[model samples]
Target: MNIAGDDMAMGGMHDEGANKNKSFGERLVSWLGRVHTMVIHFPIAMFIGAFGVELFGLWRQNRDYQRAAHVMLVVGALGAIVAAFLGWFAGGFYLWDRNPILMTHRWLGTSIAIFGIGLAYLATTYRRAPDRSRTVYWGLLGLMTLAISVQGFLGGTFMHGGLNHLAF
Candidate 1:
C-alpha cells in the first residue's frame, strides 16, 4: 500500500514496486518475478548437463548417452521457457532503453529460450539422425550451452553492479 519512498526509508516494506491499484493479473506477474532467480538455475543446470553427457557419449560412441542427452535437452528447453517468462516479469515490461544490462540479459535469455525450443524440436524430430546432421546438431547444442554461460555472467553483472563484483 505504501508506494512512496517514505515507508521504504523506515524499512516498513521491502517491495517498493508494490501498487494497491494493480489488477489481479498484474499483481500475479509481479509476485511471479520473485521466483525468476530460483527457476533460472534449473534450465542452466539441465543444459550444461546435457552438453557434458553429449560430449561423453560422442567420445565413447554410446547410444545410451546420446538418448539421455536428447531427453535432457528437451527438459532444459522447457525449463528455459519458464525461466525466461519469469525473467520478463522480473525485469519489468519493455524497459529496454532504461537499463542496458537488463536489456541484454532479457534479450539473450529470450533468444536462448527460443533457440532451446527449436533445438528440442529438431532433436526430437530427428531422433535417428545421420552422421552429418547429428554433428551439426551437436555443434548447435554446444553453442547454446555456451550462450547459457554468458547469460549467467550477464545476470551476475547486473545484480552485483558490473564486472568488478569479484574484485580483490
Candidate 2:
C-alpha cells in the first residue's frame, strides 16, 4: 500500500496531488485509514455504555438490561475489530518520526480490540444463563475499561502533544 508514500501524503494533508499517482487500491486503503478517525468513537462509547447497562441490570435484576448489554458488547467488539485495523493503516500513514509513544499506543490499541472481543464472547456465552456470576462479569468489564482508558490516553498524547499530559 506504499505506507511510506502514505506518510508523505499525510504529512501534507492538503496535497491533492500527493494521491494522484497512487492506484485505486492504494487510494482505497488511504480512504479506509481516514475512516479510522471517525469510526473509533463508536466502540468507545458502546463499551462504556455496555458496562454501565450490565451494572445497572445486576443491581436491579433486570433481564432487559442484560440483553441490551449483551447486544452492545458483541456489536462494540466487532466495530472495535474494524477500527483496530483501520487504526493500524492510519498509523502507517502517520509520520511518527521514530516516536516511541506511537509504538506504545499501537500495541495498547490492539490490546483493547482483543480485550473487547474477549469481553463480548464472555457476555454472549453467559447472556442466557441465570447462574452467571456478576463479580466475574464486572471484573472483566473493569479491566477492559482500564485498557481502553490507557489506549485513549496514548492516542490523545499523539494527537495533542505531551506524552505525560495526564500528569496534571
Candidate 3:
C-alpha cells in the first residue's frame, strides 16, 4: 500500500496553511464557516423529517402530511444551499492537497445541495405533473436519504478519526 495514501486515510494530513493568514474578512468567513457544523443539521433533519412525513401520509391517508412534507423539502433545500456555502468557507479554498477525505466531503456536500434543490423543485411540481413525476420525486428522495447518511459519516470521520472511528 502507498504510505501517502495510508496517511491521508488516517486523517494524518490536513490544510497546513490554515489559520496562518491575516485578513479580517477571511477570518470572519472562516469563523462563520465553523458554524457549518451546526447549520447543517437543519437540512438533515428537514429532509429526514420530510421523508418520514411522506411515509406517514401514505400510511394514514393524511393530505396534511403531504403538504407538510413539501414545506419541509423546501426548507431543507434552502438549508442545504446555505450549509454548502458555509462549508466552502470552512474548508478554505485551496490549502488542502492530496487529501481525499476532505475533497470527497466537499464535493459530496455540494452535490447534495444541488440535488436537494432539484428535489425541492420536484416537490413543488408534484401535484401538477403526471404520475411519473411522483415516482421520480420519491425515488430521488430515497437516494437523497442515502446520500445524506454517507455525508454525515464523512463529516463525522473528521472529528472521530477516519475509518476506525467505531473501532471498539
Candidate 4:
C-alpha cells in the first residue's frame, strides 16, 4: 500500500509540473500577441502620415511640410523595427514550420526591417549637421516612401495570397 501511495504522489507532482509549463507558454504567447497588435499600427500610421506630408509638400512647395514628412518616415521606421522583433519572436514560437504563410510573413517582415534600418541610418546621418540640403532631405523621403510602399504591398500579398502556395 505504501508503494501505491508513492506512485500516486508522483503522478500528482507530474501533473502540477505539466500545468506549470503549459501556463508559462500560455503567458508568453499572450504577451507576444499583445505586443504584435501594439507595434504594428504605429508603422502603418506613420507611413501614411509621411506620404501625406510628401504630397502636401509637393502641392504647396512648403519646406516645413517636407521636413515633417522626413520626421514621420524616421518615426515609422523605428516602429517597424519594434514590430518586426516581436513578430519574429512570435513566428518562431508558433508558426515557423506549421504554416507556409508564417514563413512568407517572416521573410517579408525581415525585408521590411532591413529597409527600415537602412532608411533610419540614411536619415540620421544626412540630418546630423545643421547645413543639410532640402534636396537631400527630399531624396531620403522618397527612398523611405518607396520602401513603405513595397513593404505594404508584400504584407498584403502575404495575407491575401496565402504565401502564393495555393493555385487558383
Candidate 5:
C-alpha cells in the first residue's frame, strides 16, 4: 500500500489516465463519487414528477394527487441524500486547489438534500390537510421546483464550463 500514491491520487485525479496508479481506496472513493451523476437522475425525475402530480391534483381537486406527490417526495428526498454523499466524495477530488464553482456546487447540493428532506416531511405531514391549506403546500412545492432548477444549472456549470464559456 503506497500511502503517498494514495494521497497524491486523491488530490486531483481528473482523468482515467491520471487514475492509472491510484490506490484501491482512492479509486473506490472516486468511483463512488462518479455514481453521483448517474444517481442524480432519480431525484430529478422524482421531484419533477411530484410537482407535476401536485399541480394536476390541485387542478382536478383530487386527493389522490396529494398521495402520489407524497410518495414521490419521500423517494426523491432519499435519493437526493444518497446522491449528495456521493457528490461530496467526488467533490473532494477537486479540492486540492480552490475551485469556486465546485464549492458552490457542493454547498448547493448539500442544501438541496437538506431541503428535500424537509419538503418530504412537510408533504407527508400535510398530505391529509384540508383544502384550505393547499396554498401553503403548493408554495413549498414551488420552492423545491425552483431550487432544483438552480441546482441543475450549478451542476451543469460545474460539470461543463460556465455559462459564459458557451459559444452561443
Candidate 6:
C-alpha cells in the first residue's frame, strides 16, 4: 500500500530500513552533531541582550529600557528551548553519565528552558495590553535574570567541574 509513490509502509518499512542501513553509533553521533549545531548560539546572544537591557533599565529607570529587556528575555527563552532540546538529546544519546556534572548541566538547562517558556508566555500576553501591570513585567524580568545567571554558572560547572561538586 504505497501512498506517496514510495514502496514503504507508513511507519515501519522506510524507517526500519533506514535504521538498519546505518550503525546505531554512527546514527547517534550524526544526530547529536546536527541537533547541537541547530540549537546552540542563539540563546547566548539573546540572553546577553536580555541581561544588558535589564541592567540599562535598572540604571536609567526607563520604561522603554525595561520593555526592551522583556522583549529580549522572551526571544532568549525561545532560543534556550531549542538549545535545551538538542543538549538533552545529545546527552541521552551519548549516555553522558560518566560525570555528575552532566546531570547538573541537564537540570540547569532544563530550568532555563522552562523559565524561558514562561517568560515568553508572559511577554506575549503583556504585549496585547502593555500598561496592565508593571509588577508582572518586573517580576518576570527578575526571574529571567536569575535564570540566566544560574544557567551560566551551571554551564561553567559542566565545562570545568566535570560534575565533581554538587554545590550550587
Best by lDDT: 1
How far residue 120's Cα lies from its native spot in candidate 3, in Å, is 0.6
In candidate 3, where is summed lDDT lowest over 10 consecutive residues?
Answer: 1-10
Instruction: List model 5 lDDT by residue over 1-168, tens digit each.
Output: 212123224332446775788889878987887777789999988998999999898789788878888999999999999999988776774533266666777777788899999999888778656544767767888888888887887777656556653457
Query: Which tens-of-lDDT digit does each residue in 1-168 have in candidate 6?
Result: 221112123421234345566778756654653465356667867766766776676688765775676677777887888888777655553434555656666777778788787876776676667567657655666666676666666655544443444565
Model 4 local distance difference test score: 0.60
Model 4 backbone overlap count: 0
Alpha-carbon TM-score of each model against the true structure: 0.82, 0.81, 0.81, 0.60, 0.82, 0.62
| Per-candidate clashes, comma-separated | 0, 0, 0, 0, 0, 1
User: lDDT per residue, candidate 2, 84-137, as tens digits?
Assistant: 888887777453536677777777778888988888888777875868776787
Model 1, span 13-91: residue lDDT tens? 3354555777888677766776787799999988999899988987998767877888998999999999999888777
For candidate 6, the per-residue lDDT at 43 reads: 81
**Superposed Cα RMSD, model 5:** 5.1
Candidate 2 overall Cα lDDT vs. reference? 0.76
Write the residue-wise lDDT of candidate 4 on 62-154 in tens digits: 656656766777788888888887776544444344455455566666667677667656656655653676466556556656755655554
Model 2: per-residue Cα lDDT at residue 44: 87
- In the predicted model 3, the residue pairs found to clash are none
What TM-score does structure 1 among the candidates reach? 0.82
Better of 4 and 5 by TM-score: 5
Question: Which runs in model 3 stand beyond 4 Å of their true positions?
Answer: 1-21, 95-97, 129-133
Ten contiguous residues with the weakest lDDT in model 6: 3-12
Task: Tell me how far the alpha carbon of residue 119 in candidate 2 is from the true structure, in angstroms, after superposition.
Answer: 1.1
Give the distance in Å from residue 59's predicted Cα in candidate 1 to where it truly belongs.
1.3
